[model samples]
Target: MITPKASPAVFAVGSLTVDVKGTIGGTYLDLTSYTATASSVSFNPLGGYDFSFRENDGLSSKRTLSISLRNLLIPSPPDYSESVVTERGIFVYEYDMKSSSTIAVTQPNPNLYRYAFNDFKLSGKARHTDDTREITCNGFFLLQELTWPL
Candidate 1:
């Protein structure tokens, strides 16, 4: 007799939240989608003819964040500008598919993952007549972390 094979578990994004506090202050609850591009690392090879002999420059390129939100039917566009170094900037949160619910499983299941970004600035913006807006933010997030809930 042959046993049946089991399918792998599925992963998905459950929720997203973006909070901007600086020259502009608002909590974007209507997040349609968002994308955070990875930052580039800077390094140099210390020894010749050996790729393994490398030293980190202790620097990384800035991260690019693109966000789409549902139009809130406002009269004017919100201001997101810099004026003499504003206080706390933007913050983004992403939760896994298991964040909203609990599951009962016989085996060990992976805990949900969370990603948070801080110190972002508005780099670009766009508005569409179709009731949607896209904004881009650039930031040098020195503290980027992914961790599970306690």
Candidate 2:
């Protein structure tokens, strides 16, 4: 849930128009199911996360942006358990084999636990004294499952 954009607009804070929304909660282990909220709540987002998005300033735009992104995957039959990094803005999560730090999924890789989320994340921080583009991240997703014995 990390989104950055820059479309048809002057840069340098001029002709500005920002729309940012974020939210994230931890404790996952979908183990397949593609996480679509049939129950078992706990930071639901259909059940899937992966956060980080901070780009778009233009420096002083002249109108030129071709940004586009879309990635979502979460569905398992069983095998997904991660529980660290507590929370991120709210995009993708599932990696807490104990603790190490390095989210996005990495333990075997085969849809480890499975994911399925889209809650919009990465918010600007700074107490909002005015607005300066804060930026935040920590939405990891690592649902695993892989076996080879031939």
Candidate 3:
């Protein structure tokens, strides 16, 4: 007898925030929306049935992370300052609606997702739309160890 594969579960976002570094080190909790595109293998058709794909050493690919937040919460310049961009980096965290208030090692909460965009830098300026500011960040790879949160 063959066992059936486990079905995927969908959960609502409880909270979303971006951790900014540098002198303006703080967390932006007013996130309206976010999109994270993890690195994917690119293929080029060589000929009949042959194809060439980029090297996938797991960390040698391009990843993108974009977030939209309330314009009222952004600074005057709109885009992140140069210092912050050169500092550590920005991080995006998301928690499930049903996530526990407190998480412990023994009782790990699998609902928490973190996207640490490596060598992250501002790829796009803040585009004002209505009352929100959309910012896009580019990096090498989004760390996804243990669990596939993307």
Best-fitting candidate, scored by TM-score: 1
Pairs clashing within candidate 1: none
Off by over 4 Å in 1: 1-3, 11-17, 20-114, 120-122, 127-150
What tens-digit string does per-residue lDDT give for candidate 1 at 87-110?
563332211111111112122233
Off by over 4 Å in 3: 16-150
| Shift in Å, residue 64, candidate 3 | 14
lDDT for residue 106 in candidate 2, whole number 0-100? 30
Better of 1 and 2 by TM-score: 1
Per-residue lDDT value at 40 in model 3: 30
Writing each residue's lDDT as its tens digit, candidate 3 over 22-116 gives 21123333333233332232211431111111122223231222232122122111122111121555332211111111211121244433322
Judging by lDDT, tell me the better candidate of 2 and 3.
Answer: 3
Query: Candidate 2 local accuracy as lDDT?
Result: 0.23
Q: Positional deviation of 126 in candidate 1, in angstroms?
A: 1.4
Residue 28, candidate 1: C-alpha displacement in angstroms: 16
Candidate 2 TM-score versus the reference: 0.17
